[model samples]
Target chain A: MNPVARLSSTSTGQAAPSGLTGATVATNAAESFPPLGIRRGVLLGLAVFAVAAFLLSLAVGSVPIPLDEVVRVLLGVQASKDTWQTIVLVFRLPKAITALLAGAALSVAGLQMQTLFRNPLADPFALGISSGASLGVALAVLGGAAASVSVFGRAAYLGDFGLVTAASLGAAAVFALVLAIARRVQSVITLLVLGLMISYLAGAVVSVLIYFSIPEQVSAYLNWTFGSFGGVTWQQMRAFAPTLLLGLAAALFTAKPLNALLLGENYAASMGINVRAARWWVTASASLLAGAVTAFCGPIGFIGIAVPHLCRALFGSSDHRVLLPAALMLGGGLALIFDLISQMPGARAALPLNVVTSAVGAPVVLWIVLRRQSFGRV
Target chain B: MITHRFAFTRPRAIHSAPDAPPPNGDESAIRATDLITGYRNGTSRRVVHRGLNLSLSRGKLTALLGPNGAGKSTLMRTLCGLQPPLGGTVWIDGEPLHALSPERRARKLAVVLTDRVDVGYMTAYALAALGRTPYTRWDGRLTAEDEAIVQEAMRAARCEALAARAVAQLSDGERQRVMIARALAQQTPIILLDEPTAFLDLPRRIEIMHLLRDLAHQTGRALLISTHDLELALRYADALWLMGGDGTFVAGTPEQVHRRGELLRVFADEGTEVRRYLQEIHQRWTTS
Candidate 1:
């Protein structure tokens, strides 16, 4: 059935109230959604932008490779120089892929958090899951287990596997605590506040661990805190990629429940949704996504909170089915751009990932907030 | 003028059992037997009203009239399964409400709550479309049939013009209509509203009440609205369920309940001023 046509036909001859006649109709007409074609066009544009950004990230680094050569190299044809192949394959490829995965993972996680909590400011880290991961990493690097071996010596021995394991455990601990608290708390705000408190407690423990540790262990932990997309190598991708994909799939599954939740829990319950079950799945999916990214990439900031809002503005719809994909693409695309800027193209020194993220992200978010007069509707 | 535009027409039965007998049949849409409604905190329990029997008949507009804190909301909540009754059984379409699954319960009954809906950036159509949640697939996409129902509901509620507008931008009256449309879209046999007219002005309240009465008469659905608008309830409701704060309960047609002095007894604590006001309105209404 043509709903729009039917709607117009039904409303045309009806004597609508005077107050709703002119200005209301004009304003409502202006606010009417663009057709599905325009939304699809936006999604297509985002996908292209993401692909372009990925190629640009591969092309622009300390040793710049030509775009065609980078494309040829990616396509498995031989490049002009051996070093170019080594540069693209060994260094930039994993890093770009890491940026893509981490960006999409965090952004999707953030979107879930915002919806689940009904808070516009909520992000993947709003629950302090990242703090829990940091605690796990801190314990591994500075606690007695690693104190017995010198920092550099232990790095060679334990590898990234040990750190990833530690981070995952920490995030899991927070996830479990949040879930337990979530079951008992009737209000999402209560859960949000409790998550914040848990985050602070984890951070406090990490600080004390840092204070007691040897200088080398402390320095190692500090470097990890700088956050990087370069840390995940080809070997680690085996675990990182699948875990994030699992989390993303779970997030996509929640699009429907999340949409229902937009009306609040009571209404959702009235509509036959198992509100408790929906909350559990949403919390689990968001925690998994946020936790996995924090495990590999350290606590990358802003992408989770920023990208969802960006997508909402760009697409002009709050529907999760649209926002999730938009967030995934725009998040990856924006992350690559940020990573490229952090690299400074030819500059020898690379800025910390978090620094570049917050610097670029904070202003854009502020602009959106100031212009819209509120964060994108929760 | 707008009232005339809302002239009611009989629509197809959107209920699951379309071929069922007409609503004038004496079957109860919802029945509460020996129901105890109250609040329980841990080991402690506070009973609001106990041993009450109430039933809402199909094709009827039943107004639950009560003064402040007379357990009207508690009773409404219990009937809708938002809260478990402290004792006894509340049945919907002859099935125990508590025993039914959430999906089954939703199919049989829909509720328009007084709780504020703060759905950000959702268009009126999308908000109304959420009524299809119980029926939609995992992804919640609406089928063509579902779309037609939603369109029909919006048309019935007279808010089809507001379909493309964001819910956040709508006035209270407009929002209430959209909410009613959502309940209509649910295609349930029974709809319960908790103070659906609370935030509206007198004209809007009268309009809403008229729309609801017409909906019940035309669609053969049972509607029970808990409201404080006694004058309107007396004028429009098929029956009145009076809940006295002192735990007394009475149910009958407005005139029957008034003749029995249930209205005076329910509002006795409101002092002589309120008693005089009630009697004066009742006298004017009946004499006219």
Candidate 2:
């Protein structure tokens, strides 16, 4: 620790490859690795937002219960059949939870994508994942005219497991196709363009379906495109939570290999990773996260494309060990805050969630582009 | 006899010492022989080299050299399990290398390929800690033992001073050491480097080679490196594995390598002097 000791220590390196030690077991280098102050700060901020949003989601609505009453009900200290408690626990909680889960899923998917492509602007929706979900949703909503594939021997038609499953299948299909294209194409820019083309192709299909459908079906389909957190029922949540968690977990497990992959496939393979399997898992997890959220919550936007960049800006590094957790908390908190605003308080005119998301997410994105200097290339 | 001692400025004795230790009593180190590897793109599934035999003498430095595409990189990659063999086998100790689990293989062999692929924020120390991943749990939290090894590896790699810098922000030479530090933390018996000095500037490249030499000599570990710098490889390496462009690989002492005309064949186009002077100048050119 002293200057003299430090001087003596440096001089030893010139003499030999003798490691700086006395052979006694020393402190682990990894533990000694300093933690990022910015990341720790961002994490604290996210925790605050999560708690505030959860309370606001319970307290803000047409009923407008006191914050204390909402807290009490959540803690089970008081009982009520009042609309406030009902709305707080069942309607708003489900919607709030949906927003949180959906946001985290999309953000993590986007983070994985940007890293994989080595492109700054890559995101889940930007890479055709949202469109894949849209096609699946359109097929389900407009299928009233035809024989739909029944999930459990009966067609629920408007919103069924068949539809959600179809969305996942569509997303998986698109992801698989994109990955193959990514492999064949040498340039990252070309990959981004190919993804956009896929999105347009899927978007065209959805528009054509909307054009031919009955007015009622067309209306339902239109609402889905605008995006919402209100459609997830308890039944939907039961299935949604597990798949999303599994997909998130899969993405998390790949953190080490994904870090190695940034160098190239050959480099990753040399480190003893199963390159083909890693790519497959990457596709599977991204599609699952994007697909399920799209099917149940509608085709949300802005969150996936922007949250990851924001996370990087906040954390100031690309390490997934930190990025994944930051994305989870930040995405979930932001989504909850957006959902709370979606239900217009005094005015009867509630805004679609996408409009609110764009207002909030866009400025930050613009700021990122404007000051791309602040956040250097990863 | 294998003379694998650290702190050697230059050996007074010619070749190995008259008295050298036996290969060793440990039955779990790497021993390679007659490895053949190559690529299979499109129509051609060309063999890199056939009947190219070499032993990765335990506790010694082994340098593999040849021209750009003479398959030195391919051979190193194959040894690391990234590429597959066209013929012959590579064994770890007395057992088949591939027969071991990937985790087990990681425990025995650590590799530093010539590419930078990290996409996340990591300090030099943290990157070095990843070397302990095979020994750690699935969560990859470093245990007491993992921690001890990582620190020692960092010291050996001489990356302690840069421990706090983000890997993304480090210069090319420093980043290379960070990676080598990570591999050292793995504490594998066999370490393979593929043109580790390629991107490094002169002094940094020599420093890396010196570090590798130290690790092998001190730990009784096997070190194999692929490089285009023939003179440096010839001078420092205990054994030379040379691959010629005409699909021939021969391994022996530096004199044996030259005697086979393998060095001349790979370093020159059909006709040119295989000047020891040219070798020195070419090496100086890289450093300069």
TM-score of chain A of each: 0.85, 0.79
Q: Give the TM-score of candidate 2.
A: 0.80
Per model, the share of native interface contacts recovered reads 0.40, 0.27
Residue B30, model 2: lDDT of: 52
After aligning candidate 2 to the native by TM-score, how far in Å is the CA of A236 from where it should be? 2.9
In model 2, pairs of residues that clash are A263-B117, A318-B120, A318-B121, A319-B120, A319-B121, B29-B93
lDDT of 1 by residue, A1-378 (tens): 233233344444564422112222222232232232126878899999999999999999778899999999999999999999999999999999999989998999999999888777799988889999998888888874446653433552367767777788889999898888777777788888888898889889988987887798788787777789998889999988998899888888888889888888888888998888888888888898899899998999998988998888786677887888889899989989989888896687989999999998898778776866654342
Share of native C-alpha contacts between chains A and B (below 8 angstroms) recovered by candidate 2? 0.27
Task: List residue ranges in candidate 1 displaced over 4 A.
Answer: A1-38, A145-159, A180-184, A213-216, A371-378, B1-26
Which tens-of-lDDT digit does each residue in B1-288 have in candidate 1?
Answer: 112211122222334554344233447888888999998889999999999988898878999998889989999999999989999999787778898888978888889999878876678888888888889889877776676566567766778778888788898999999999999888787889999999899999999998888778655678999999998999899999998879989999988987777788888888888999988976785677
lDDT of 2 by residue, A132-244 (tens): 87777677767545444534213334345655676666676777777677555545556578778988998898778777778877776677677888877888889888989
Displacement of residue A214 (Cα, Å) in model 1 is 5.2
TM-score of each: 0.89, 0.80
CAPRI tier of model 1: acceptable
